[model samples]
Target: MSYKLIPPGKRRNRHYWLRGTIAGERVEVSTGCETRQAAQAWAADYVARLEGQRVPGIGEVVAFERAAELYKAAHPHLSKSDIRLVGAVAKYFRNKGKACHEVVHADLVAAADELKPGRAASTKNRKVIGPAAAVLHYAANNQWCTYQRIEKFWVSRKSNREPARDEDLAVLIANVEAPPRRKKFGRKADYNVAFKRLLLLMLYELGLRIGHLLTVRWDDVDLRAARLKVRIPKSDEIASLELSPVIVSELANLTSATGVNRPALGRGVDRRGRLFPWTTNRGVHAWLKPLTDRLGIKYTPHMSRHKLATDAQVLPDKKAAELGVWKDPRSLHRYQHVRPEAIPGRSAATLLALPAPDKRKAS
Candidate 1:
């Protein structure tokens, strides 16, 4: 078929585009580049993938909704926050009342264009940028419309910052460590000690999202394997995680006191299976803000993720993917809170190192 020139590379002069199959069919295809040789090579390989029914060179055409459904399937192991982000995208787009079948790249771009620079820029980051890009990227992969890049028009450049130093984070952790505030007669002391301890262990050591951590049930943990299964809510994927021995011991200690540390002045009733049963999302922020205030740690729940993704992610294309932060670094501004301390590398780790991701038997 014919090819259209499109802006290439995410950031700068990476102006390149590919020619893929016609809309709607699954047959793999690819074409177009500065050099005819490169185009021919990609085209040849794309046809091979199509013929074998392998992962085809995809197009960039599906609307936001269609693409998101595919993204959910692709990332069966996303974290809870990621699920929230996907949900946000779906809600925002659907709320517009535009038909999913009729939406196009122009509609998405027009939507992105409507975002104001000085706006609160809070929810827009995760809602508009991260998941929104995922919807587009998936389509681009399928040859939707040579996706140029995802822009962060929501976040003003004023608030962005480099990764928060771990040393700084440690300082913040210490401030909030006064043996859990408790009530003696009628005062409201530290709300929940065991849960707070668990939260810190997760943020500092386990690198878990507060949302997912709150959803964690005792059953998901494999003590023998020393791993936790972080199920990505949006994509419905399950990612295996490694726990440092220190956190494991801390969790073990807390489990021992589950009933002893129960609320209600005497003994807190331990729920049967759920590892944590938070009454609301307020507790997380309530403790974190006060803790950070006392410790002088200037960060939020997601800041830990950003810190972890930046520090831990060591692989290309993996830093964002594994951390479930953003589809690409450009959208980083909107979801800076999700920035991870580490970018996992391909050759180094095996947490999500599964073979034949697309071909694996349904679980």
Candidate 2:
């Protein structure tokens, strides 16, 4: 219930009014008295409004499943994963919507409890509850749902976990290089030599997302300059990354050796592509996870971005501010003396760092 406080009248009388309904029974309470007395009286009347019911709007609850359907209908063109995730969240909320009471502190806590059973934090969290809360917020906005969407209502509290150490990165790299994935002969072959690893490396080396990588063309590479152009996803930022001769050589060799080239990578094309003709992000993650496990590394696609930011900040030649925090000038001071840990002694480490790519030339 909400109240309207009125000032004292000429005769010193004031009006206090309450609004909102109980069990779909719209109720209004008014006290031609002072604000304090009216507030107190309204609280008493609110309890009176719900005297006999366990929940005022128990049957009016909108299931998460239903909410998800509405959300999908609202955004039919979302990415495949995003659409799938919306469905997942809807199912999750549908299960949680079984409660008999309006959302309370306990209901929120209970919701958190249910979400905590999942072992993968990212899977059960940011990707799941975060998006689910977004849908609920949308529902609440449209008046299709009652509960006020809250961050804590749909997910558990998150803690700050530090990223992987370089030593761990080294171990993971080593493991992938030496271990066997599927055996061609009696011995297992190293997993990442396939196209997925190259794709991953592009993300690491150029900070390119999979969508952005799919748009890459061969002519964008300036092998002699040891630089490449990557038009970033979702932003106007076209990054010009400097690379090493060895890195360039690796890509050059792959292009030359592939049995057939994709039309996207053909002459006169304007984007880079998966070094392997056909692949997906799922395949890359599938291959990378085992390698990471064997090496006891907790690496993910994001680690490459972290490695770049962390390493760039530590570079003796790089202005600490230029490390990765592009928007704020104040952060340069924080990393003033810090330098990125040296990468594993790979030939690519010797490459030059490239500036953000110039995209104006394309237009």
TM-score of each: 0.48, 0.46
Summarize candidate 1's per-residue lDDT along 54-163 as a digit string, tens digits. 33344323445555666777878766777777766666676676433455556555555464244445555555565677766666667755655655545454336444
Model 1 weakest 10-residue run by lDDT = 345-354
The count of backbone overlaps in candidate 2 is: 13
* Regions of candidate 2 where Cα sits further than 4 Å from its true position: 1-65, 92-112, 115-123, 144-149, 153-204, 207-250, 256-273, 281-302, 312-363
> What does candidate 2's lDDT look like per residue over 140-188, in tens digits?
6666556563544332333233333545444443334434446556775
Model 1 lDDT vs. the true structure? 0.54
Q: lDDT per model, in order?
A: 0.54, 0.51
Please, what's the RMSD in Å of model 2? 15.9
